[model samples]
Target: MSRDGSPPAATQGPASTGFIPGNKIFNRRDFVRERFGAAAWDAVLALLSQEDQAQVASVDPGAWYDVHLVERLISAACQQLKLDDGLLMEMGRFDADRELSTVYRWFLRLIRPSFAIRHMNLYWRRSHDTGTWRSWQNGPEVSAELRDWAVSNRAMCITLLGYLGRTLELFGGKLASLEHTECRSEGHATCIFRTHLELPADEPRPGRRPTRADISSLARELAHSPNREALVEALVTLLRFQFGCSWVEVWVTGQEDRMQLMGVSGERGPGDQRRFVLEVAGRAVGRLELELPRGPGQRGVDEVLAELMPWVSIALETARVDRSEPHHVEESELARRLRRAREIGQLTPRQLEVLELVARGKTNKEIAAVLGRSEGTVEVHVTNLLRKYGASNRAGLVAMFWGEL
Candidate 1:
């Protein structure tokens, strides 16, 4: 009986057959023929002993044959061609691509990774019934153990690795990894596979910290940015330097998902469900989205972001010239604002820090508490910003900081 409950197809190898499915043999034939050329495939066979050659040449893909034939044939090919067991891995990969029926292959491609991997046993039994397949799947991770199954060849494990790895790829995994943790030939009771898909985060991790060096560099680089595009590029480069590999972007804050700044150091997949709030003055003014590479995040990003955010705020403020901006500020608007504000006197970083608190509706006392300043000093900053923008009060001062002036 097979997974579908009917008797096994005549070509399907059953547990009693002591042989892999005959179609797998056909796949090997095709693999050798396609990869090595027709003549080279013959050369491979010629390396085998005469009796083994005769048996292999006369092999019927629909009939059961000795499993040891694989061991002998693979060994001969490797020894004569100065090759390695990577041939078997390639052969297994070829089988995965060529063996599945066209309709079934497409069906598998259209489904989710979790669903397909969870029901992997059913797919396994279709090819070999000799072993018990124990599988567990969690979101993007899957583990499968093969107990009491020996193909009489240790090199075959490499083939299985390639086979299952390609299987994950076929089902829409981009940066998936497959590893064999335990091997029966190595005296382990079962052959275990640990598979993981490096899926992007579904949402932001609040307070995710970047290092202090990253923070300092971000501010320094941004301070030198000459244009809006350059500012975004600087941020992208900073992330790549921090992560070693990353696809990072600064997306616009409004309802529109229109993107502003993006940098890709490595390849990216289609879906990226993660985004951290890019903030200024304690508001999510934008998003820091990523098409993360194939590894865990490095440690301590949030502390850096906290120090880095105000600088990013100033840079992005200069870049708010896009048509998407509801304010419809002109391309040279920030330059105009900077020039006009300077006529009232160039403001210091401490003055900008105070303005940030004012924009958040903080009173002088509240702003003092937040910035570790006296209320009197906070009141002077508010008074100076107001005088600089010719504003009547706090409300107009905040509006000028937001580029309304």
Candidate 2:
């Protein structure tokens, strides 16, 4: 100020203007966005790894199985990738096997991230050099360890594929596909899976993270569901669509800790049963349970369930209120007397109009204007209608209307 002008008139230095050293401003939003993006990427990787491990664990290499576990895993994964509304539809084991091969092939072509895939090639060397399917001897090079690892790896691959497929499928509409190819060589079994990865030009990209408003809207919708049955139905619908569960049920607790069946959805397997307890506001309200597939998880479904828990608790509280006993009512003698008077007197239309207007706290002049009649006419109508209504005055008429309606 001293250097540039006559007076230092309301001047801001470099620090106040945010141009000085150590004057940096941090934005919490931008920081959170960066962190969330990183976390999502990490989660995707972890899920892929976990699914692979699950598939591998389900295999027995020594057994003469017609269908490979890896193939099934891939199929389940691909179906999951393509599913709509985060639902896991029921598919047989055989179908899952077919799907794995399909997803593996598709992923190679479309979403070909730099990942290695090992396909198992098995063969039997006959004790005699006879080229037949039967009477095969163990080859010198193939050890038990190798065989076990192959089966395990295949299973792991399938599991990984199932989860991956499901995750992608939830997003909808051809973001990926699966293809499979197997080759038979001289004396060994070999399956070469060429997963085709296709990243189409018009393929949809990842969407923006849900805002607080979006979460709030979903919560409100969940809360506003009409009744307990409707709320339980919503929960069942969520499990079916999201987790691909076989069955779901909800229970509400009443006095003396007795449980009531609130709602049930889907059918369970033979002799299968499960249960969960629901608690809200430091009190046990109800429970939810479901029968799930003994396979890789559908995380999208789990995520949604976790998000809905608070809303679910809120719904239970609402149900508790509805379950309470209703208010008591007994008609007083004065109420009875009014009804008798109204029946005895046949009040005119004008009188009825004036009576209602007076009960609503309008003056005679106001009632006359509303009815398009003279104030005197309105007064007379009031007198007659009051008699017809069997009320002593405006107060009695209001009470009578409240009781009858």
Which prediction has the highest TM-score against the true structure? 1
Tens digits of per-residue lDDT for model 1, 318-360: 5554313443222234334443454455766466556645765
Clash counts per candidate, in order, are 7, 51
Q: Assess candidate 2 and give its lDDT.
A: 0.40
- Superposed Cα deviation of residue 402, candidate 1 (Å): 48
Taking the tens digit of each residue's C-alpha lDDT, what string does model 2 give over 1-405? 111212111111121111111100011112222434545323322333454445333434333221222233323333323322112222222223333343233322222121111111111120111122211112111111122122222322233233334433422323233321222311236433222233222121222322333455445544644455545644554454434566666666645666655554444654234455566767777777777655444454445555666677777667446545222212223323433433555543334334445655678776665445788876777776666666798777677665663
Decoy 2 TM-score against native = 0.26
Best by lDDT: 1
lDDT, each prediction: 0.58, 0.40
TM-scores for every predicted model: 0.43, 0.26
